[model samples]
Target: MAKIAYILLCHKDPEAVIEQAERLTATGDCMAIHFDGRASASAFRKIRTALTDNPNVTFAKRRVKCGWGEWSLVRATLNTLQAAVEDFPRATHFYMLSGDCMAIKTADYARSFLDQQDKDFIESFDFFDSNWIKTGMKEDRLIYRHFFNERTQKRRFYAAYGAQKRLGLTRKIPADLQVQIGSQWWCLRRRTVEAILDMTRKRRDVMRFFASTWIPDETFFQTLVRHLIREEEIECRTLTFLMFSDYGMPVVFHNDHYDLLLSQDFLFARKISPDAKSLKTRLGRLYAAHDVTFQISNEGRNLFQFLSERGRTGQRFAPRFWETESSLGRERELLIVASKKWHVAKRLLAAIGAQTDIPTIEYLFDEENTPLPDLGGIQRTLEKRTRHRRALMRMLFDYYETDRLVVCMDPAALDLMHDFFSDRSHTRLLRIDCDFSDSYLIGHARRVGLAGERAPQATLEQLLPTIRNDIANEVDQIRGAGFSHHWAVQERASEEENARAISNFLDLSHETALDIVRAPHLFAD
Candidate 1:
């Protein structure tokens, strides 16, 4: 049988992306990588250096200067697929991914999962699905007059956001192809990728219509699949976990999410920070036959911290091609707090990021801990002196510029949340409720590495439900007078769905937020 092919779409954090490629390729799969042209040469160079000795790896020549919500993202993705088509003719399944994604299961397990199926694995939603796209967002993308922004040097950013904020006269939807949208991430047979590429090349009208449309990455492949394959030939899941807040912003992942990552039934989990040292180490150890192994790098950690601080500020920087306004002037601040579970915060924030342009600050308490595998290596310890941890929290809180704050039921910060609520300022609190339900039960089991003889188990699963109840009771009194948005993290799938609602509530550029929520294409992945 032909081995699987892994197509990695990368930007920033070459270390994480390249490492994922190396690990997957080592599993007898071939690799095709595409780097965005706009990325600094050093970024691409880092990937090249990492893969230099690996003969199974290949890079695409048709590199695109990918911009957020731009057609370049589609070009880069298709170009890589096209190259893979020609290069690895026998690749059984072409798995599409970003640099930040990590395999939840072993590569062998994932390959077996793909190899057993002849159908495509993707998450798709009809553009006409009122359930997924509410209000005017859907109508605007399909019916509005849109320009790809750079062609006219206009609202490049919002045009990609895919909501109503104009440039030209409304354009009619193409009669040639059906328009559909979904997560850009997918796992498809080699033949499916090739057929889509072929159709895109031969159908000039199809390409043109999508090229000018916002977030063609989401619509293009989905339409191709619906056009070429039968519904019976499709598997309706992307198997990647990308959490969004109720407001439609991506929940940033952290080390504390390690237990959550392993607990997931998904094969891939998105968006690990390139510099998330602790999380990466844990992932490496988990996948390394459950034996602890780590490549020491402090540079990745420092860079992550610096970038995180920048993200917290009102500093809204877009690609050279995008046109945007900074929300720094708006006092509409958001803080994500979950009382008991780290996954709740991740899910809520992801939902919020998807809907709004307002920058969010995450006051994460690093409880994303599970027992270390029985291997001896440099272990990261999160247990800190309570006083020191509290003091640091105070310092960070004092300096955070705020217009709105969300407390996710963190009792440690209840006093602070209460202070913000009682104040005369306009800060708002968005409370997230993550019930200790069935999802929690399964996750607790996974963190113990149970369900099979991979590791020990049993006790943590029992106490988690109780902890969930205790935290819920403690935060009942901290309601704020400012604007507040409450959301839930029910499980893996539901948590990510909320990013869109959160985005709309935050008043993100509708056109731009639409592209993100539909495609979830932040890093070309």
Candidate 2:
């Protein structure tokens, strides 16, 4: 009786979309599809043919000419979600996905898991964090008015190049609604998906504002969902894995990533190619979400046994797939202690990973138990959840004896370690300065007594100015207490400039230092 409604927005590969849709539909799913208006009619017919046998699949009538960085992308997804909800009232969960993604988990486990959970699964981050602006949060996305069909799909529009010529914001962002941004692909409870559709209808102005804005698809649902649902009630994580190249483009899944895919418990992995069709057909059903699937290929049997022997604990304890600095001759020096602001740390780490002098570093991030960062290559993480943030940081500082110790952490973690690392040689603290909105952070603090990293003592009125002062005070205290080297960088600066500063401070050579200044992430592939 359980049903999951899938809303898929794809511009290419009708056949592939049909194949996966059938797999999902087989698992008691009602499907809603939206092919890009720009797609050929033949492609549309092919998709319809693929789903003709299944009465559960519905196609959106208001198809969108989906273009990258355009509002139409958001429109297509909304139409698809609305169609799915309207068509299948019994479905409790709705998954928003791309055509390229294929399911790694079985339908029964997915349904069972949703039945047992109370949280709405969606990936979101602190939008108020000014540090993220450089990570592709363009200023125009909020202030300026964007008109539809501004450019044709055949030619790539260079908005960043026309930064000076681009339209500026006509009005200030609303005071009440706190903005949040994250991965566009997610699985949400039916209520959450319905809430998104309802908000678009009732909050026309909000939708209007994002309509012309570039790539609203990434933020529209995320910002609206946070408004309708409680932050804790929302899972703020996605189950799909998309790999990016060193230049940040998605490539088709190849044999090289077999271990990487099998290690993690992601339900779907994307950019699958036609060449891999045989491989998928051979061993597709064995990957389950909550438990191991018995099905496997002969090559995978031994690899599965090897991972099982390592005490694998479901998705959270997947075998890490990255190259550690120790693999080379680099010594342990950089220690990045991050929290929910781990996204910012990922950008910094990406730049560091490119350097020849990269330290045997650790991006230690098990604090909130959020999804680990995908740094475009093989990613590995030591997942250790710490009950005490202040204590774990101190233990890590002394535990590693390196010539230069670098730390990127929250204010609370920094405050606790102020005196501890004061006199240590070659110790550097890269303080992450951020500004949170009033409603979410301040309002939640009043209800829960502001106990985490920020100054729990200051009331809401004093919080606005006091929070920044606290970061400065903490930095000053850490310096006076005894750290050898220290630098404070703004999160709002261009990601490249931020990386450049860190690269210079870390004493990387000037020639390739600019390499550290990478471009921000565009819309998800």
Highest TM-score model number: 1
Q: Quote the positional error of residue 134 for candidate 2 in Å.
A: 5.4
Q: Report the number of backbone clashes for model 1.
A: 44
| Residue 376's lDDT in candidate 1 | 17
Query: CA shift at 371, candidate 1, in angstroms?
Result: 45
Q: Ten-residue segment with the worst summed lDDT in candidate 1? A: 319-328
TM-score of each: 0.53, 0.52
Tens digits of lDDT, candidate 1, 324-374: 211112223444444445544544444444433222334433442422211
- Per-residue lDDT tens digits for candidate 2, residues 331-378, read 224444332244556555545543432322334433333322333221
For residue 478, model 2's alpha carbon misses the true position, in angstroms, by 68
The candidate that wins on lDDT is 2
Q: lDDT of model 1 at residue 341?
A: 56
Cα-lDDT of candidate 2: 0.58
